[model samples]
Target: MQPAAPESAAPAAFSYTAFALSLIAGLALGIALGRLLGPLPGGEAEPWQLRAEDRNHYMLAIALEYHESGDAARALDKLIALKPAGDPLVALAEGACALGSGGYLADASGIAALRSAVQLYQDFGREGCAERLLPEAAPAALPAEPPPPAADARAQPTPLPSKTPPPASAQTAQTARLAPTPLPRRFREHSLRSFCDIARPAIIEVRTVDYLGRGVPGQRIRVRWGESEDIFLTGIKREYGDNYGDFQMEEGVEYAVDMPGAAEPLATALSTGSCYSDNRRGLKSWRVSFVEV
Candidate 1:
């Protein structure tokens, strides 16, 4: 029977051609599918790709320019593009713009937003900025006198005699012409002594470091105390230790802190009452540092 036609022999030429065609068809199908799908939205240039410091600087610059130029609408538009919707810094900038633009001043929400921004800035140690955002106090109105009791129909008006000053003598007039000498005003120099007076329990120091244990600047640190929350930007005055984060804490209350851009946030807290009181504490603040591992 011709040795059963060698059962283990390779496939025919047609089988090889079929296999080659199948492989080619699969590659073509994959290419067509890829083209149909296209790239994902946002593509490779994603928001997360931006460094935190760069983003903050960019936003702050835009905010400052808007603050100077009084271009509220444009500033708001740019801020919206940056997506700092819930960020207090951006909110402060927005409030400044609104105050300049005049239109938003009448809106209740706008007023509330500015107030919130002020509080946020104050808590975060940006008191100067907060003060700027604060609205000017309205002047108090004087009480109006009641109209002369409707002309009493029966009562006759009485005229009162007025006293006139006697003619002044030449010597008396010369004395009157003399003005009191102006007194020199005393100026008090700014001092941190008041800050030093706070008790230790009320002071807290914060610092930040990178993976190398070196100081990190331009960090956004958020602290929560009881029902209140505050946020501060690090490195404003590097001379006072740019990486140092200093804040006052209420005695007996606990505080929690975190850095916004940290991959693994180094959260820490303190119970103020646990520490000893120091008379010089106000001048000396407490400190905490976030170190990347």
Candidate 2:
């Protein structure tokens, strides 16, 4: 009798949180750097003298373009070695990238986020726009706004609730409980917000191809994930799936698969998130399987 064949390893489960973050980081880095350089969608390889016309989004798009090729880990090296304060695109993409890379939102605050966006907007208009977008009075941390007091005349001044502080024991217990939680094991690590952030820095384009070495046109492949029943992000798979894999990218959408072998999906199944990704790139887990003619 023939010897039994070795079983294949089970595919790694994909983490929505992890991969999303990678893409975010990748795009942000790429954009920030590209913007610092100039006119980068396809203009010059690395623009030196920055132009006044360069938008904050230009470089971010470039980074997304970088991810279009997939492989976040590789893209990360490019991001780590950057000096991005001078350019607006660099700043904004870097901020959003935290979520795209999908692990930790890191230490950036909401005020920082709005400030970055505002700064870029300022570049477009003048001091007026900057005043509105990034107001001088804005708090550094920019905590959420407080609720307004009631205006009804009939509403007698209700007795204000007394501030009852928690017992010292309770406070100490809470602190102790939180202290033992490690960085990787925290609940915040697994949230959707963090996941999307991490993947942003890691996503690449998903192109399609056929058995032959020619570009496959107009074929729509669905990107489904094995980890969850939901489709990862199903969009019109790219047109230039030849060099890449059967796929094309939608603008702004990034694809990420922490689930190794979760790459190069074979068939579409309902369950995972089904939608289009920015038509630029994707990362492959499974070997590309071209549709046979």
Per model, state how many residue pairs clash: 12, 86
| Cα error, candidate 2, residue 245 (Å) | 6.2
Worst 10 residues of 2 by lDDT: 185-194
> Which candidate leads in lDDT?
1
Instruction: Count backbone clashes in candidate 1.
Output: 12
Q: In model 2, where do residues sit more than 4 Å from their true spots? A: 1-206, 226-289
Please give each candidate's TM-score. 0.31, 0.16
Please provide, for model 2 over 1-293, each residue's C-alpha lDDT reduced to its tens digit, 9 standing for 90 to 100: 98766655555588788899999999999999988775556555442224422322343333443323433333334434333433233333334333333322233343343443333322232111222323355343422333357688677776554334345575465344321212211010011221122233323333333445343332223343333222221112223332232222234344332222222332332122223346533332222333323
Off by over 4 Å in 1: 1-201, 261-268, 274-286
Best by TM-score: 1
Q: Model 1 over residues 161-190: C-alpha lDDT tens digits? A: 333222346336533433332332111111
lDDT for residue 290 in candidate 1, whole number 0-100: 66
